[model samples]
Target: MTDVDLTADPLHDSPALREFFGDSYDRVARFAVMLADQGVLRGLIGPREVPRLWERHILNSAAVVPFLGEGTIVDIGSGAGLPGMVVAAMLPERSVVLVEPMERRTQWLFESAKECGIDNVTVVRGRAEEVDEVVEADVITARAVASIDKLVKWSAPLLSPSGEMVLLKGRSAGDELERGKYVLRKHGLVGSVHEAPTLEGLEATTVVRLQRQG
Candidate 1:
C-alpha cells in the first residue's frame, strides 16, 4: 500500500467526482479520504488507491447506481464500502447491507458511515455464502470481491424472488460474463452485460445484471 498525504487530497478538485456524487459531495469526499488513509493502515484498501479515488473507485462505483432498482441492496464483501456505502449515500430511499467478514473492516464501515453521516447502511460481519439475512435482499452488488461465478453462487440465493444483481466488473467484463454463463444458468437466473456510463467521454464501465428467469 502506498502512503497518502491527507492534506493534499485529490478528491477535492475533481469536478467529475463532485458532479457524480451530487449533494453527497462532502461526505463522499470525506469517506474517500478516510478510506484511503485508515483503509491502507488497516490493509483494507491499497494506499496507492487514494490518488485514483474518483475515476477508479468512486465513479465506477457510482455508475452502477443508475442500473439499480429501489429496494434492499446487499454488497458482498463490502470492503471499505466501495459501492455499498457509495450506493447508500447515492440513494437514501434504497436500503443497503454491507457484508464483510473481517471485524476490522466492518468496524471501519460502521465508523465511516457514522462519521460521514450516512444513515441508510447496515454493516454485517459475515461472508455472503453463509449469511441467511443476505438472501432476503432485494438486490445484490459487489466490486472486486471475486469471480462472477463465485459471486452469483454466494449471492443468487440471497436476492428476493424478484430481485436482480448489478455487479461492477473490470475491463474484462465481457469475458467474465461469458465465463460465468454456466453458474448463472445453474442458479436459474438470467444474466446480461451492459455498459455503465459515469464520465461522458471517459471509458464506460461494464455492469452485469442478473435476475431469476424461473
Candidate 2:
C-alpha cells in the first residue's frame, strides 16, 4: 500500500475543496496522501477508509473551518489528524494542538506535521480531560471522539471563558444534543446544530456548536 494511487480511489479529489483550502492546499493534499499511504498500516485508519479519505474525512474536516474563531485550538482525540491536521493545514496562522492519548498516534501526528511542513500545530500526548498544559483555547474540536455530554465535559476546562466547541457529527447530532441537554446546562453552555455543506455532490456535514451561555 506504500504506492497508493489517490486518483484510482473513488471520490479522491475535488476542485472545490482545492479552492476551499486556498493557499494551504498543498499541505492538506500531502497530508491526505500520507494518510492514504500509511494510515491503515499504522492502525490510525481502517483499510476501508483509504478510498473515501477525501470525501468522508478530509472534506468533512474542512467543514469546521468557517465556524472557527481566532487564536489557539485543541482537537480532542485527534486520531489520524482528521479535523485537527486539516484545520492546521487550512489555517496556518491559528495554532492547533492535536491531543491524543495513544503513543503511536502521537508519533504519527508529529511525523505528519513535520513531513507535510505544517509548523503551526503541536502534538500533545494525553487525554483531553487530564492534559492541563493546553488551556484557554479559543476553539475546541472533536470528530467522532465521544458523545455530546462527554465532549462538553472534556472540553469545558480547556476552553477560554468565551470559547466554544465545534464538533463534527453524523445524522445523530440532533439526538446527541437532546440527550446532552443536562450536561450543557451543567456546564453553563448551549448547543446548536448547523449544516455545513462541502462540495456540490457530497452530503452536508452536521456541526454541533456549543458555547457558554451569557
Q: How many collisions per candidate?
A: 1, 0
Model 1 weakest lDDT span, ten residues long: 1-10
> RMSD of each candidate?
2.8, 1.5
Off by over 4 Å in 1: 1-11, 133-135
* TM-scores of the candidates in the order shown: 0.90, 0.95
Please, what are the lDDT tens digits per residue for candidate 1 over residues 1-214?
2225544544445687667778877777667767776877888767776666677787778889988887888899998798998888888777789999999889999999998888989888898978975347888899999988999988887888788899998778778878889998888888788888886776788898887896
For candidate 1, the C-alpha RMSD (Å) to the true structure equals 2.8
Query: What are the per-residue Cα lDDT tens digits for candidate 2 across 1-214?
Result: 3435577666555666667777988899899999988887899888888777888899999999999977798899999997999999999999998999999999999999999999999888888888866546889999999999998888788988788999999999999999999999999999999999988878999999998898
Candidate 1: residue 24 Cα off by (Å) = 2.0
Per-candidate Cα lDDT values, in order, are 0.81, 0.88
Best by TM-score: 2
TM-score, candidate number 1: 0.90
Model 2 lDDT-worst window of ten: 1-10
